[model samples]
Target: MGGRLPLFRDLLPRGLLGRSVLIILVPILLLQAVALQLFYGGHLDVISRRLAGGVAGDVAMLVELLQRETIEDRSWIFREASWRLDLALAFEAGARLNAVERRASMPLLPLEEDLNRALEERLRLPFDTDWQSDPRSVIIRVQTPDGVLHVEAPRKRLFTATLYLFVIWLVGSALLLSAVAVVFMKNQVRAIRRLAGAAEAFGLGRDIGTIKPEGAAEVRQAAQAFNRMQDRIRRFVGQRTDMLAGISHDLRTPLTRMRLALAMLPRSADTEEDLSALTADVEEMERMIAAYLAFARGEGTEQAAPADLVELVQEVAAKARRSGATVEVVAPSGLMLPLRADALRRCLGNLLDNARRHGRLIMVAVDTVSRGEPGDEAAPAWAQITVDDDGPGIPAAGREAAFRPFASGAPGGTGLGLAIARDIVRAHGGEIALEQSPLGGLRARLRLPV
Candidate 1:
């Protein structure tokens, strides 16, 4: 059962269009299949039986007429049966269905059964009916004292025209209707796609324009809710940014005055160290303020554009190498995604800086992978970016705590790297996780939908 779940999970579609069409189409197909089975099994069988029985009766009568009439006179009777009864008559000497100078016949089972039963009840003499003996006719042999009488009837007698027409109409109508449904379904899903795309872009903190809701009523309602939510989030971020901006402005002047006052103090060894300490504290306070303002203002002011992830990671690696950090990278070419390039770059920069500061050997890689079945293209694939390093990794207990604002992983650390990275990642509709890397240190894995 556990194994079966994965098989069905892989087979099912991952998108609205495919899923919706599948949902509508599967039952229709099944119903048609059931209908076909019922028609073929029940009604078609009855029709074929009646037709075959009629052909068999005509065949038996032709055999009887050929048996009674003389050879010369039989030609005229044959012509009469051929024209009136539609049975082509022939008489052959010494032809037997037995093994010596004969062959067994393979008949279409439905026709064969009906013809055999009808001929048995109607005919007094021994006879052989071979449904498959001729492609265009039903062949019957009647054993007589003089010779064997061969009777040929048109094969169309064994099949009803209405049956063929019904089946063809059923199949053709099913296909035509399915195609029309697909066209309408694609249009309906198009509107839903627009709604989903807008929501995803907004969640990623991009400056998203409004979406015109055009789907079913429920879908339109969802889109309206999404728009309202976006408005509220933007308003809240704007208010917070304004407040933080005012506070930072008010505190800077007093800090500068205090710094100048300390610098102008008389040169005394007793107070110099204390003044230096105060200066460092003020600088740290300013750094915290900047980090706070950055976080508060990150409600998505950037427009989205297509950016190559591989090149972005490579550029980060090159810059870190220039600063004397050993970084190894493995990435595929042409890995493009719609993103806020500057914000993503800053987010990755923070993670790399943090890793480089703690670990000696660092590695970065960008790859695309399926969330479940690897080969299924329809299953959603994620673009994954991994940064690994050789340093003591964070404990499982502190991993979640590390993403909290102002919660530093180490002593004397600002503790905003992972938090900011997480914020930026989540805004892009991605996820970041901390885990133990193969290099014996923390591994930062980031994933974005492609």
Candidate 2:
């Protein structure tokens, strides 16, 4: 039984809605089968016995009349029985009875045993049925004094059309009910589909709107819970960002004041170098504060829209070129993605700036790639953006450390560039991976879902 369970599971539907409908449909089908079995096995057997018994009495009377009659009288009886009772009778003078009954080797017809039992009790003679020969009628052979008495009776005397009607009605009603349930379930599950789609969009940092509760009671409760969760998460992120923004603003005030006071102080020739160094330290602090504020504020609630990803990457490459960085771009035209243009631009800007700062030569490649089974025509596509440069790449061991904010690794960087870029990429339902470039530097592979 355990071994067969997997086979049954494979036969079952794979979706929630399908499985739910199957839960309703399977029982109806099984019950219909049971009802059919009970009808045919018990009730129909009794009816067949009663029908066969009446026909047997008529066959026995005809047989008795023929046994005691002259040739002419037997001929009249055969004609009368054939007309009135749908019995075709013939006398073959020298035909041998089959040693084995046809029923022994043939497929069982409905109530075949009942017909044989009735005939054996009434006729009291050796007989063989032509179960193979006729379809619309049954031929009963009885060995009598005359010869082999051949009696051909309509098969309906033993098997009527009611059984066939019962099976047809049972199957047709089940099909009708299944179809109705499918349509009804589709409507019922619509709310669940909406709930899932809304949750997915929220995870990807898209706008989450108010969801109206629908479906069954349990399903409505789930939708309500999701709505509450969404509200709570938005509130939490908003509170943290607000707190950090306030902190970042307060920290910048003293650093700005210190810079102003230092500029105002009269510098001696001996102290000139120290003043410049102190000024540079103040500026670095300001930059760090700015990066922290940006990270805290998050890419802002940027609305996603369809934009040309190729154009977006080229724009970043163009900006890099303007900044005296050697930039090369290879991209297909008009490759659009549903994304936040500002957030993605900021992400690409950080990655490009990082590459240009480390390496003299930089390359940005953008294309839409399909991810699915090989040769599948309906595969979904991904927008791939890769930034490669000839700088000294971070080691495999330190690669993960590069994305941490203010981690001590690089000499001049605040260590927030990769972290900021990752936050933005993840918000757009994309992934950023760092690997050793073929150009002997860092390769930033940013894959965005289309």
Candidate 3:
């Protein structure tokens, strides 16, 4: 039963709109089918049988009348039967009923069965019905003691038009109800779709603003909740950024004063080496302060926009090359995706800088890849970028810890490079990870949705 549940779910529609429509249509169709069975299967059957019986009774009465009347008078009887009973009759003298070809019965239609049963009960003689002989009539040949009697009964007499009318009414109502359900459900689903799209864009650091509430009461309530959540998060981020900016200013001022004091210090051969070491320490402190500020600022209020990732990778690679690193880039001409350009640049810059600082040979490559099951067309694709180098790579166990702030693994490093990179990448709804590179060093991989 558990295994079958998955198969049942797989057969159902995936979208809410489709499922909603199915929810409405299934019951309606089933009801119509039941109504059809009750009406056509029961009431219509009785009506058909009655009508067939009346026709058979008429044919039986005419056969009895012809047997009693003389051959000359039979022409008048047939003429009267045509005008009064709506039946055409012809007498075949000395003709055998066995010679007439019998037509195949239509099992699906109850008309043939009802008519045949009625004729058998009424005539009490050998008779065959030809439903296919004429479209408008059913040919019935009866064996009389004198000869074979040919009777053509109007097909309409054996069935009521109410059967067709009932079916059409059922179908028409079902169609009308289905159309109304689709229109109403589509409007409701549209509102939900808008809410989802807005949430996705906001997650990717694109400010889509608040979405207007529409649709049902529940959906509207959810949208309102989402708007409230967005407002709260934005306000929180704004407050944090403002606080960080003030701290950066206060810290930089003291560092600036310290640099001036160090510059004014009297220099001598003995103190020169100590002064140089002090200067390097101050510079390192400044670098650490900058790294801290960058880490705290994050993507920094940058709105996402469509940017060519390939061009960005090449630009970062060119910058790395100028900084005395041998950088090789392999990427397609254009791979555009929504991004906070400066934030992503910083993210890539950090990865490349780390590589340049540790490794001599740097390799950058960008490509598109799918992270879904095989043959899944609707699976999302990502723009994948890898920065590889020939430097010493971090062990797999410590790679995850390297993303923490102040976790530098090398000398002259502030330890915030991987942390800042991961922060920026996550802000853009992407991921950054470190792995062993083919170049025998660390590989920093970034994947962003395309």
Candidate 4:
């Protein structure tokens, strides 16, 4: 059943006008061919009878003239007068007689043999009535005062000229119609192809210049809709970025004043703890605000270029080592890939910081992954970067909520790290998730599409 499904489900639309033309033209051609058959068939019937009647009339009249001429003068019998009359009459009637006979006996016409037989029987009228059933020839009998005279003329095929004419008409019409359909289909497909390319460019975040509203009305409407959507997205993103930048600028001034004021506190024994606590609170507040600002103004937002994945991981690991954290880099391939460099750095930095804060050791593993099974669905080629730690892993149920802003599993933690990391990754068109690691701690996985 599965093997047969493709044969049954030929579900992709062939095209609009192509299918429509076929629906229209096929039946039209069939009907025309049928009408041609019927019309020619009638012509054959009429022509055959007319030709046979004309011939019979000529023979009767000629015979009557010959008898009278012979009676008038004895020399007329030996003078070949009948032959001369026949030659003269035949020259005049040749075209009409041949046309009728050919139409009557045309094999291409419907039931030609039966039609010929009927014509022969009808033309046997006052000429000579004795017609043979298995006739290859026309047998004529004339009653005379002396005895009876017998004349025989072979039968000939009818309707050849009509068949040749009809064949030319049918073939010529089909060729003309097919040529028209081919030209029309080609033009339509070209327009559709242009629209498809424009759509793909838009999806890839490239600026598509004004789309020409060509083709059918539906296609034009779709292009117009796409243009509107792109305009809206650009406006919204611009406004949001401006707002975030303004807020960050306004906030730093107060935090700077607070830091200056905290420095003026006395270092006395009785009140040292309270002063230290207050200073610590100020620093934490400043850190949280800075994190918020960083999240707001995402890295590489203004620029993106290709970078080497394995080298970037190694650089991050080196930075963590300098900061007194145990981090290792593992990569299967040294892949140079296109990415927003600063955004990727910020995402990886946040993960490394989180692991250092909560775990004994950090493992940064990088590899290429095929995200699904091979056959039924396409296995997407993706870069899989996993940051794992050796500590108490995040609980299964609570892992999903950890990426939300202000969601903290640890005490004295602001919970903005994972949230900011996920945001940065998403902005770069990648996905990040938390799962249990083999190291008995949280595994942060980032999958980036190529």
Candidate 5:
């Protein structure tokens, strides 16, 4: 039983539902137990007191008969009153008295050594209490011509019965309530779980269809709101992607014409400077336009197959090194992560390029893990991709703004690199953040959920 308790405990999440139910039920059970004790004790006290009062009356009657007979014949009265009451005759008057004397008390006659223990074990309460301290209890008194007898029975026996009954009722009730709560809560959680799974798929760029709301009204409202938001974002993205594609296509013809005209111009010393400036301006404009188009197209949301992340990083690093950039794969071993092939590579390539362009030396590392089961020790299921550099990192205040389009702080560069990288990463169900690196510069940490 003890072993199974831990097993049951592990099946539940550390959530509010379990805690709330426990908080509510525990006190109620305790209260019920206490109430049962008090109620049973009260009932027993009433019964005992009535019986004691009846015994007192009978004793009084016996005393009166003895007194009258003694007044009439003193010797005869002494002989008759000296005889012990017969069990058979006592039962004829009251069957309960016979049972009490015979079944409850008969064994304690001459066995003085075991008398107290026997009575307590058989007829006394299961637990002990001070009956003398309690006002409500049975008080038996008898008066004879020779002497007076007094006895008191504690009300603890009643309390014990009540306690036992309370436990029985409580256990039965709690079981039924818990079962019902499980069924109802399961139904509520099922819909929410389904919605969460769908949301995860959506986050990972999977085509999740509209979810039908379920459970309580509030949950349904939240599901509906999410659906509406998703639809709006998708529609806006589709419209913008088409618009950017058209703009890029249209701008290319005029750009081609301008380049041809510039090339056809007569050559001169001043013309060379003027043409270089013209070309630079055109190229910068073109690059800005391309970046805008990429942003508008929602490039990250594209569906791509899984690729070897380590290999991808290695290839990017190789390319950068060939371009005379100081980028190295510090810890690229065992980086087998499930990821969007093109998008993930693009993200890493952009980050390395950014580091080389802004920072001095660049270092990249990857680690993969699996999430653990409840009560079972295991690693978290995710892959962390870290890009570290020893460059003049962006200030804390402007770090957030650096991801926005055209928000660059470097000379001879557009500020679109980080933004594009983030979009691509997020589309693959990953997050990218910039923080102080161990390399004394900026650290780009990317976490991808498996």
Candidate 6:
């Protein structure tokens, strides 16, 4: 039962619009089917039997009347039967009913069965019925002692026209109702789709202004809640950034004064070494302050826009080469996706700088890859960027720790490179991970949705 549930779900439509239409259509079809069964099986059956009985009784009465009269007198009886009863009759004297007993050929309704049963109850004589001989009438032959009595009875006497009209009404009403459901459901679903797209864009640091609620009441409420959440988040980030800006200004002023004082100190042989050490400490403090600010600011209010990843990788690699690193790039001609360019540049720079500082050979590669089966358009594709180096790689156990702030594995490092890189990548709705490279060093892999 558990296994079958998955199969049943797979067969159903996945989208909101398709599923909604199915929900409306299934019940309507079931109701129509039930109605058809009741009418065809019960009411229509009764009407057809009564109609067949009337036709059968008329034919039986005529046969009895002819048997009482002589051959010359029967001519007048036949004429009366034709005009009064609407039946065409022919009496063939000294002729036996020799034609084969014909059965109905795929009668659509119960008309044929009703007529045959009625004739048996009324006539109680050898007879045959040919339903296919005429499209508008039934041909019946009664084998009497004198000869064969042929009767052509109009089919209208044994069938009701209301059956066809009822079927058509059922089908037409179902179609009209289904169309209305689709139009209304599509509008509702469209509103939800807009909401989802807005949320995704906002997550990637793109400004998709507030959504205008247009769907059902529940959907309107959700949109209102989302707008409120966005406002709160923006306010919090603004406050934090303002506070950090003030701190940065205050700290830089003292560091500037300290550097000036150290420069003005008198140069003496004994104090020169101590002065130099103090100067180096001040400079290190300055670098730490800058790193801290960068880490705290994150993506720094940069709006996401489409940019060529291949171009960005090449540009970063060029800078690495100028800084005396053997940087090699492998990427396609073009790959465009939404990104905060400067933030991403800093991210790539940090990874490349770390590799250059520790390793001799730096390798950068970029490509697009699917997160699902090939040719599955529903699955997302990712722009994959990999940076590999030949330096000694961190062990598997310590790789995760390297992404923490102030967890530098190398000496004289700020330790926020990996942390900052991960922060920026996550802001762009992408992921960054550290792993062992084939080059016997660390590999930093970034996967950004395309």
RMSD of each: 4.5, 4.2, 2.5, 10.1, 10.5, 3.2
Candidate 4 lDDT over 280-368, as tens digits, reads 88778777777776765554244557899888888888999899999988896688777667667777888898898899899999997
Candidate 3 vs candidate 6: the TM-score winner is 3
- Number of the top-ranking candidate, with lDDT as the measure: 6
Query: In terms of TM-score, how similar is model 3 to the real structure?
Result: 0.91
Lowest-lDDT window of 10 residues in candidate 2? Answer: 101-110
Pitting candidate 2 against candidate 4, the one with the higher lDDT is 2
Candidate 1, residue 216: the lDDT equals 80
What is the Cα-based TM-score of model 5? 0.65
Q: Which stretches of candidate 4 lie over 4 Å from their true place?
A: 1-7, 10-214, 297-300, 375-380, 411-414, 427-429
Clashing pairs in 6: none
The lDDT for every candidate, in the order shown, is 0.80, 0.85, 0.88, 0.67, 0.65, 0.90
Q: What is the alpha-carbon lDDT of model 2 when measured against the actual structure?
A: 0.85
Candidate 1 lDDT by residue in tens digits, 1-450 = 999999998999987777877888888888888987888789878887788778767776676777687777788888888899888777777665452333434342366677767777877667876655577877777777677877887778876676668778878977887788789888888888888788777777667767777778888888888888888888888888899889988888788788788788776799888988988888877777777777777736777789998898888888888988899999987698987787888788888888888899999988998877758878888999999999888998888998988788665567887888898888878899999899999999999888
Candidate 5 residues lying further than 4 Å off, grouped into runs, are 1-13, 23-31, 44-167, 200-204, 263-273, 368-382, 426-430, 435-441
Which wins on lDDT, candidate 2 or candidate 3? 3
Which candidate should be chosen as best, given TM-score against the real structure?
3
Cα error, candidate 6, residue 245 (Å): 1.5
Model 2 stretches astray by more than 4 angstroms: 1-11, 45-50, 53-57, 74-156, 160-165, 180-184, 257-272
lDDT of 2 by residue, 1-450 (tens): 999999999999898889989899889989998998898888888899998898788888888998899776677898899889888888887677767645542244456777789999999988877666777877888888657888888877877788889989998999899889988899778988999989889887877777999988988999999999999988988998989888888998999899999999899999899999999999988887877788877785888999988888888889888998999998886787888998888889988889988898998888877778777759987789899999998899988888888774556677888998889888888888999999999999999999
Q: Is candidate 2 or candidate 6 better by TM-score?
A: 6
lDDT of 4: 0.67
Once fitted onto the true fold, the runs of candidate 3 whose alpha carbons sit more than 4 angstroms away are 97-108, 371-380
RMSD of 4: 10.1
Model 6, 223-307: lDDT tens per residue? 8998898889888877877788788889989999999999999989999999999999999888888888888777758988899
Model 1 clash pairs are 204-427
